[model samples]
Target: MGVKALLSKPLAAYVHKKDRSWIENPVEAQQAVFKSIVRKAQATRFGRDHGFSAISSHADFVQAVPVRDYEGLSSYFNRVKQGEKDVLWPGKPLYLAKTSGTTSGTKYIPITSDSISNHINGARNALLAYVHETGNSAFLDGKLIFLSGSPELEEIGGIKTGRLSGIANHHVPGYLRTNQLPSYQTNCIEDWETKLDQIIEETIDQNMTLISGIPPWVQMYFDKLMRQTGKPIKDIFPNFQLFVYGGVNFEPYRKKLFESIGKEVDSIELFPASEGFFAYQNQQQDKGLLLLLNDGIFYEFIPVEEYFKENPTRLTIGEVEPGVNYALVISSNAGLWSYSIGDTVKFTSIKPYKVVVSGRIKHFISAFGEHVIGEEVEKAMQRTMAKFPTVELIEFTVAPHVSQDKGASFHEWLVEFSREPQNLEAFTDELDQQLQKLNSYYYDLISGNILQRLKITGLPRGTFRDYMKSQGKLGGQNKVPRLSNDRKLADGLLGVAKL
Candidate 1:
């Protein structure tokens, strides 16, 4: 990016003031966040007392609004898509971020004016704070590449709207905007055959200094690059400084990606879903720190106390303390109120707010109804993995579905390692039992009796990402769901023909 553009308005704060820490005082900090949506709720949308939304205080509004996922917002978004404004925001939106569904349908979430400004500034502040913590911002000047969704726009009634990444790029400081690498992805092209071919064509021969994307797609792209070029990935992008990934627990895919490239280096994960960029790397190098976007989205944490006890403790950003695991809830400028992002985190320290990824809260399997969390499973897997030979976990999914009629019960595990196991079934089963032993709940379930079915199947070379890409679900926001609770989904995924 040119120095002149980097010195412009939106970037000035990020570029020049990158060294500064957060500036707002306590009360002002609270108010700055509170007003992001409250003022709109009370405006012309509501005539008298801004009669629009009924909830008064922050907590009141949050309490009044029930949590919802993508399906709940579909119709309202369809209206915005039709070029008729609905209640998401008062003004015309700046862009629509493209996202996919479990069935692979496309979603164009509105990028409102407030949301645009909040995202840009919030990202800048995140970078600023990261630089402050690291003591420099030279990475900002490096060639940055995002593993993003397609930049294609769609119109319900023939009016061209914007894709999420394109709009985000469009809003960047005009000077540095051109600094972003060209994306060959089209937001609307989300099918297996059409999208993967384009991803393969567009991503070749680029000097990607900084790389970003869902880990599965990034890994898939690089594998294809290695096959066609017959050279290590390091040779393709010699300037590549870092790997930025998110959308799924990166550990599963990261190991394979690094191995495929024939090397390893430091990496960062940007945990952003279609909702908004929730958190970025805190730059501490200890563990992932969820530096709360104090001003962008009103953040809340639900304590594990609820998991242990009946009533969960919910803490606001201001109330967060050290060593407590929380299931996060967010209310953003884009109109998602008390939205659950489905991940669990624990604060390791307070003053600057450091956190370790605890696990997925309600998103894991409960075979024998044991309620094994992602963190529990991941921790056990990591422990066993740390001692094993250089083996890869090609696929691991837990399915709780049992034949109740047959009285069968157990967590079924499927794994494909890099180095062939001397006794594949025995080794994998022992690992499974060891993992179950670590989580007390799973232990009770298993100790009672043998599981209905526990299977381990080996994947032929290049199966995981090839399947994901062949299915045409590659890019920035989408990822291979690492952990799930459903048995059928697991079975179907495992049974699918190899790519």
Candidate 2:
């Protein structure tokens, strides 16, 4: 083993041992984090306004602060952007994570000095957790590629501003910097395709052992690699043993990724966002991600069914139950108070608080009250794929198709397949049946004849890629929405889908 790998083993074990302290005392750790952040921010403008000084408990917190999305918090964020100190957190934020918002045009999420560690350490410890468990630190010896946004930043009110991934690039540990690729200059290229091409050129012959990115984009890289070399990724990067990914669920892309790799390799799933680094897959055998409790954030969970209701109940760490879908809310040291990051999660285990990202609160098909979520659709697709081993999917999305002539409505699945099932109708039927089994509301709607059975529209290969390219979201944490309530994305997709 090289010096880095030799050092990493003991360090990973130490980190894992320290993490057990927080993981074993979930509620206590959360309570401590809640008190610390709230007390620290008590003198800030937002704290003063929200009665943070007088708050004593979770109930007091609920009374003092209301849940808000980025739009609702814009007034305070505006002040921060214009260089207002102590408006949200104490003094100025270290960085502003700029992201494209749906209803709101652009969003600037604060990242304070105290909170940046959550993002940085959360990713580091995920690897450590894997290393400690499996005694595999050999990847530390080879090149590790993080397919991310440009490391370049533009200043907003003197605070560094960029995409979260780009911002993270600035903080990679000095020890690992030597092993990280592609070159900083190549990473700074503005266009994703250009950057990807540069990345391939730079690292095609390197001793790459770890590759990290959102699944679809990583798939794109793998496809490009195979096209260029006419070989699977395993042959090109024989030492590559780890695939670290976040943003989107991996199952839909799992089969394709493994096929491209030519073999199975260990992988890590992370739940990271501009708001905070929330969770990571700690155990290779487990599907759920270990939620970070002692990080600089206090978490709340609102039952997703009641998310749109007035005065929705917000439950703390101690109150959340396993298997319940909840809209994740957080108050972090970054100055966000009861902020809804729009993600919905279901706890698979509460002992150590392991959760699976179920769906986005807004990313669901509820046009007919069926309320099918991203998780349901993905699971259904997974089941269908399992049933038909020959079937190979590139990407897919679900949208409601309401008949213009007052006929029955149905869920339309836009799918891009690399290898179509021998019986496409049978495949569609299996997918629909799996969805109905997972979602009772959808089952009821189908059974009541209010909605017809789901229909599958075969999209030509690269259709989704072309669509993302047109939208200028071709790579770097961008994901095609799995479900949409309306037909905007569906209509746009159908135009180029060639029927």
Report the C-alpha lDDT of model 1 over 58-148, residue by residue, as the tens digit. 5665455545545655655666677765356665566666666553277666666677676666455555554455544445565566655
Task: Give the Cα lDDT of each candidate.
Answer: 0.60, 0.93
Worst 10 residues of 1 by lDDT: 43-52
Per-residue alpha-carbon lDDT of candidate 2 for residues 244-346, written as tens digits (9 for 90 to 100)? 9999989999998999999899999999999999999999999899999999989999999899998999999899999999999999999999999999999
* Reference-based TM-score of each model: 0.81, 0.98
Which one wins on TM-score? 2
User: Which residue segments of model 1 deviate by more than 4 Å?
Assistant: 1-28, 44-56, 70-86, 103-108, 122-143, 156-163, 176-179, 183-206, 304-314, 321-323, 356-362, 405-407, 450-454, 462-472
Top candidate on lDDT is: 2
